[model samples]
Target: MEEFSPRILPLLWRRSVPARRAVGRPPRLSVDIVVTTAIRLADTEGLEAASMARVAAELSVATMSLYTYVPSRPELVDLMVDEVLWARGLTSDGTFRERVLLYAERTFAMYRAHPWLAEVPRARPPVGPGMLAEQEYVLAAVATLGLPVRELNRAAAGITTWVTSAARHEAESALLRRTTGLSSDEWWQQRGELWENWFDVGSHPTMTMIWNAGAFDRGADQQAQDAYEYGLGLLLAGIERSVEGDDRVP
Candidate 1:
């Protein structure tokens, strides 16, 4: 089998053509099966657990044979990420703000369900159909507003970025609690006692006041969600103001 290149990765993902196979014999594996198995491993364990060997083992195939469908573990992971994102439907009907918020909420839910996605390094944009579909969805929502091309791209990116950050926060916190066997409240309770003993509350009157106001009593999950919704509202409001101020926008 030939090595996969960045130029050809999109072709492979879009299924521009079926993968090369034997003439007289039916293939025993497929790219979808390989990616699905890898995703299962990652979802059940962690990203590191979805090694080529483990994925092949789970599929009951020779490790090298697995390469016939997926060129490398990185390629397989890329495919898995796209597959997960593709499964999520991102569409809604409402005002522009409402549509954007609905999409943000769905993206948040997806990341929470697949926390391993937070570990993936997206240094470059993904070109997979799934990712592009998501991009198209956002652009379609904002297209009627008549924003410039630059602002349109920025608006789409802003909403997704906000959701990704919020989702990562919640997912990381949950993972930490699972690893340490301590709930957020329990961990903070212990820290609270230590602060009472050695910390100088007088040094930070503003924080001290907020802390005393029962703000911390709200669970971390609730606080994270509240902050995300509040911030999203502010973000949408700013965008609306920009649209209204710029006569160029429709």
Candidate 2:
């Protein structure tokens, strides 16, 4: 068995790939090019579609040539994830909550841009430089909240979890719409009627009451953008309470 080295595929930053031969003409291929092509393939199709052969085909190069720069598929995927995570723009200005919200929004937008990111498995801890930079940015934003190290780590994790899940849902909704040829409203409208026809409203009074109130229509599914904002607001409120040292439930 052999250990993995992080230096094998350094695609976290925008840099040219090492030339195949040390004393020859500039390398025609670069790691950045490979990773970018890989990301584009994943974005257009899905993660599974971004195979090394497919990426090499897109790059007009031989599959084995790619291995010269990128060690393997898993390494390439790691580079891709780090590259996108590095794209998140974090700011330390503004109040703590404001900074956190801005960071979360930017992170969410990044996930939406590269939805296939959710498909990547975290088999090991993130040891890439880009991931470390992101963690530092997040920790700095929440450092002033007067939280213990454990609580601070938990808060950051919670924020990332919420943003990732929300953005993944958004991406999935878009994919579903493309596959089904139906908008959210259209899909839900058909399902709403089925529920109306099949369910005994008399027995489920609470559900019936809410349904009659048009809550679901005006709720989470109607406008995902609004739903995201609403959820973010609630999450921010909870974070605010935690910051104020009132994290305990009533």
Candidate 3:
């Protein structure tokens, strides 16, 4: 067997894609044109629907023509995510909940609106301003804690990761639940009829109370709150703990 241990990789994965100030014959494509082309392709068709070739066609150019702009698929998607995210403006005036909630909801809405965007694998040293704005917003909310810049970075990253992961999980689980005619709720309800009855009233008193309460509403199903409030609240609470405890910034 041949041991092909390691290899060189494209700089796209290593360094930030350099910002281009020109488009067409001037030696670069306008970042807006490149990003907009990507967004239009992804939006009209789907994430999978957008490709360098397809985007070029959408732009009425040769497939090789796009190479003058985005270097690769990952780079293109990064551009598109950042481009589409620009619609979510950042506000600095709100309280902890308000500011943080704004970031979280914006992130969740973007990913939910483009489910495929949630699946991209990110690299260290984020490369887009839209994402950078999100981090800024999150840190601004926690600035009162007076944490070191590094700790603030961690808090902001937590908020970012929480929104992306939660939205992805929610979308996937909803799809799976729908595939089965009976949701997890219906399955759990039927569990009571099973012979082994793990949720029997005598064995599970708490569950019985929950079942009786009917907390799970199938139609008009609502989260305790939308993803923004839910995720933002969690991060704000975490910051509160850090502030109140020995975890103060160094």
Highest lDDT, which number? 1
Q: TM-score-based ranking, best first?
A: 1, 2, 3
Off by over 4 Å in 3: 1-31, 122-126, 147-150, 169-208, 218-221, 224-235, 245-250
* Model 2's TM-score against the true structure: 0.82
Candidate 1: pairs in clash: none
Query: What is every candidate's alpha-carbon RMSD to the true fold?
Result: 3.6, 3.7, 6.0
Question: Candidate 3, residues 166-234: lDDT per residue as tens digits?
Answer: 766654444445456665556657665673544467887776676578754433224423544566676
Per-candidate clash tally: 0, 0, 1
Model 1 lDDT tens row, 29-123? 77778888888888878888899999999989899998887878778778877887777877777778777877777777877777788788755
In candidate 3 the C-alpha lDDT for residue 210 amounts to 62
Per-residue lDDT, model 1, residue 125, is 41
